[model samples]
Target: MAKALGIGGVFFRARDTAALAAWYEQHLGVPGFWLQEAGLTIFAPFPADTDYFPANRQWMINFRVDDLATLITQLQAADIPVETRPDEWDTPETGRFARITDPEGNPIELWEPPAA
Candidate 1:
């Protein structure tokens, strides 16, 4: 049987699509049609009552980065609030993680997988 290859795109509603798109491009370096580097992509389905993300939102997007510390600093310098849980979220096996929200209140996860 043939299996799905990978995620083609992510679609969601935004109050101002143009502004939101630009914000992503400027802050996170994600464009409308991004050519992402090949890496691990997780496909998880959470329970309805899961509190991993905001209760008001149905979905969250995760993006893998090479340098989490630099990215966090850049985001903070741009006046964007970034949440990190080093003690609770980071590990030698999994790597570091950070969380941030878009202007429209969409949760975004930044992950840096452990080095090979």
Candidate 2:
């Protein structure tokens, strides 16, 4: 059977399109329409009241990062807010993960998967 394998790109409505795009480019180094290395991309929509993600949030974008701690520090140095849970947030099986919110109040999950 034919099926979608991974996400091509994410498109969303923004109040100030140019400014918002610039924010992503400036802070996150996310090149618009940028090509990336090979990996699986998950495209999912949770229930409106789902606790799988933040309730008041519209959506969350998770990016696979190379170094979580360094990236966190870099973002903090830039005065960006980042969330971390030391005790129960991380697991032995999977690698470390951290959370950050974009200027538009969108949740971003920075995940560093366990090394192969």
Candidate 3:
């Protein structure tokens, strides 16, 4: 049987779609039609009561990054708050993880998988 290849796109509602799209491109470098590099894409479903992310939000988007520290610095310089729990989130097996919210309050996960 044929199976789904990969995620084609992510759609969500925003108060100002244009501004939000621009913010993503400006800050995270994600454009409307992004060409992502091939890598591991995690598809896990969390319990309804899980507190991993904001309860109000139904889903969270995770993006793989080349360098987490540099990206975090760039985001911080732009006055965007980034949350990192290195002790709790980072590991040799998994990798480093950081969390940030969009201007419209959407959770975005920045993951730098362990180097091969």
Candidate 4:
């Protein structure tokens, strides 16, 4: 039997590809063709018209982060945008979360899982 262990890459269309790539690198510290931490890979395909995220956008990209507070502050200082609704999403078991949009209007969810 064949089985897949993890996501290899995430390739998507962008309006200004180079600027978008730079946005991820400058604000999110994620270079394109990334090999993320701890072999942590996510594979989930959102529906074409999914409202699980904001309705204005067609797709969302979720990334896992280590320290939410520090990252949020750094992004703010750098003039990178961040949107947080902790009361709407946070729970005792799920830890903290925030949201942001890339330069191309693709949403990126920042998730920090609860510590053991």
The number of clashing residue pairs in each candidate reads 0, 0, 0, 0
TM-score for each candidate, following the candidate numbering: 0.98, 0.86, 0.98, 0.84
Off by over 4 Å in 4: 39-42, 45-49
| Candidate 2 RMSD to the correct structure | 1.8
| TM match of model 3 to true structure | 0.98
Off by over 4 Å in 2: none
Please, what are the lDDT tens digits per residue for candidate 2 over residues 11-38?
A: 9888898998998887777888877777
**CA shift of 78, model 2, Å:** 0.9
Measured with C-alpha atoms, the lDDT of residue 69 in candidate 4 is 97
C-alpha lDDT values of all predictions? 0.97, 0.82, 0.97, 0.81
**Cα RMSD for predicted model 3:** 0.6
Candidate 1 residue pairs in clash (backbone atoms < 3 Å): none
Enumerate residue pairs that collide in model 3. Answer: none
Task: Please report the TM-score between candidate 4 and the true structure.
Answer: 0.84
The true-versus-predicted C-alpha distance at residue 9 of model 4, in Å, is 0.6
Ranking by TM-score: 3, 1, 2, 4
Model 1 lDDT per residue over 5-77, tens place? 9999999999999999999999999999989999999999999999999999999999999999999999999
